[model samples]
Target: FDVTFVNKDNLPEYVWANSWGVSTRLMGALIMSHSDDNGLVLPPHLAPIQVVIVPIYKNAEQLKQISSHIEPILLQLKEMGISVKYDDADNRRPGFKFADYELKGVPVRLVVGARDIEKGTVEIMRRDTLEKSEAPLEGIAGHVKALLEEIQTHIYRKALAHRQEMTRTVDTYDEFKKEIEKGGFILAHWDGTTETELKIKEDTKATLRCIPLDGDTTPGVCMVTGRPSKQRVIFARNY
Candidate 1:
């Protein structure tokens, strides 16, 4: 239910519910949480274009040859249910395409020039790490599939690590106030009362984000009121 733990005439009732669909908030969260200096850093599974192939060539003939070579690779990737984009438009340069796709957060990018074709390889770059390497074109599709999974996992772990680093535990109201100013989640004991919660918010401008559903639930006393508290709640200025 949208409204939980409603109180009526000094009586309380619980409502357990969930939201099934997603909204624009999911998109906002994706961009805000994962983006960096270069641009968006989308997880592979979430990226609309998981892989973008950019052709590097000196002339029209070279572009035609490169496109012909990449046709089979593109078909292979598509057959494996991977989204791919082959951008060979002469209107834009290769560097511009690279930067555009990087900003768009394409998970993986493959660059194949005449020289790379002669060597039977392509230059691959990962958006999350911006690391580039050359890989043979023979099994390039499978290599890309594996690399996408790796990128997904790497970005997820990186974001989790950042969250863990930002979370802090505070034992005193004064410490909570100090920590909240620095930004990030603060774990602090809170008396189960509206008065104390409101007072803390009024004084420090931090709100109780949640009474964490799991983890270290050991009993403790409220930092602000010194009342017996069951567990620590999460507090933050804003997400």
Candidate 2:
């Protein structure tokens, strides 16, 4: 139920509220917002395993050496509170490991080949854009922390942009009915009456998702009833 305050005596008559937090919708939202044909494109902060390191070498001796070289690097990452995995399973090739982690949505991947160990570097790959770059292991702790933050911001911006693009601004009821069919957020003026809100939903199955915190404030008339409205509210056919 939408209630303004914890106690009935503490709220203004017009204020509205609801229980807002994580729910079953979170999984659906994440999948719809970010996942692609390649697989899930998880944001770094939410990934259970943020970094996966795959070791590549031509021989058992080099594999042993690479392991020794990367042990310190893994420890450094762990000390920085970065979740890391050294994928040392011998049954799978490095290429297979890469594809596996990419499918599993590890936000960051490091390929530590024999050459990289000799050169004191690692090949880092970002899952979001599938971009790879070589980075020296020196001061890797700080560099990785920054990269994770960048990935987080990048994904968030991309999702917000998608939402904005999906939204429609309508000034007429006919346009509302037609736009609602496409199924995204709708920005429209309403008559500030629950009767008009319910009627719109009955006719088009669209509901007022919210009067956006930063919604349009220009004086206008409701799209349905033409009654004077002070601002535009967000309407949507949400799941």
Candidate 3:
């Protein structure tokens, strides 16, 4: 059913949008595009935290004491503009939390239990590469901030490289299909007609994602119809 609401005593313009119902599918695409057999490799900037602090304890008293100590540290980190999460949940094991956080792409994790407290340090784990280091409890906020920035930059560069490696230009339908199967954006000539667009979609399942913002205005023949074309349009099977 379509419901209408009056705004300022006038009808508003109706905008149409398409959906693939692929929110879960998009996550799958990200995993396929970015992950290895080990697990997900999330882009650092998109990661929930550059740092996560997990406190381990054996009993209620120990948990309370550890939490009390960590609160000041968490506050300091927050004051310094660092995003931090302290996992004190009793429902899950430390190993499970570690694995789950890594899968979710948290950049850094710090484990502070009774043992680490005795040593006046915390176990800091890097999620991107499973790297671990010991960081002193004092002055940890600044150190974490710097490390998170580094991870963010590193992930962006890696994603850019992956995109570059996957993209290609094609001149023929046969070549276009071959590259598209490998999964990436394709640049090719089009006849600029709805009929040609429909035919291409019928054959390749590809659609015009957009007439790109900066397409070159050059004379060419349409790959499908052999019709004169002013420029090429971008085509892709979008999410």
Candidate 4:
């Protein structure tokens, strides 16, 4: 039976049947993909606050000077259409603010203190690698903009590499079972039948994740039944 729609002229029309919905599962996927032991490592493009400025100072006078120096850089970033936050509140300590913004997934963090002002430099940290470096105050805004773009690309490539490392190709049911226990994507052949799919699930608790629309389409034999198969499909244990 074909699933489709009816036209205004009372004629049956062909349309692609699709399923769509919004859920918090997307948030879960984001956290699982980029988060680390420290906290969330959000890509800059998706971050609400792509950059956060944390002022490190001992006294109000020191903060006043630091804020004076940081204000221009903050304005420049905002002018360039980059979302940024200047955290100079007196209640929270600078260390606490650093931890909070890091946990919240701000991609770039700039720390400016009395010494930095004297040296005409700011300490910058990127959440993706948690690497810190010093940069002169001159043209800091433009540097941060470029850093955000770099962070986004670096995290994406890192996640891609991780996925590739975790994925496995197996030609035997015994190898499939062992790989499934390790928990990642498994590419294996399955005879195109509902009974075979159900049998595999019953035995291993792994299901066909998807039949990729693109990729290798070479013929193979089902690992379980030794029957001819069209192509390999992604199989994995759902969480």
Best first by TM-score, ranked: 1, 4, 2, 3
- Highest TM-score scorer: 1
lDDT of 2 at 71: 90
Residue pairs with backbone atoms closer than 3 Å in model 3 (clashes)? none
lDDT tens digits by residue: candidate 3, 72-180: 9899878877777888999999999988887777778889889878888988877666788998988777778888887767766777798767667777778777777
Over 4 Å off in model 2, which ranges? 1-18
Evaluated against the true structure, the overall lDDT of model 4 is 0.91
Q: Candidate 1, overall lDDT?
A: 0.92
Tell me the TM-score of model 3.
0.72
- Residue-level lDDT tens digits of model 1 in 1-239: 44657577656676765563356767888888789888999998988999999999999999999999999999999999999999999999989999999999999999999999999999999999899999999999999999999999999899999999999999998888889899999998888999999999899889988788885698999999999999988989964
Q: Tens-digit lDDT track for model 4 on 8-105?
A: 99889888654542357777888899999889989899999999998888988998999888888988999999999998898998888989988998
lDDT (Cα atoms) of all candidates against the true structure = 0.92, 0.88, 0.77, 0.91
When superposed on Cα atoms, how far off is each prediction in RMSD?
6.9, 6.3, 4.6, 4.7
lDDT of 2 by residue, 67-111 (tens): 998898899989999999999888988888888888988999988
Each model's TM-score, in the order given? 0.89, 0.84, 0.72, 0.88
Clash counts per candidate, in order, are 0, 0, 0, 0
Instruction: Flag regions of model 1 displaced more than 4 Å.
Output: 1-21
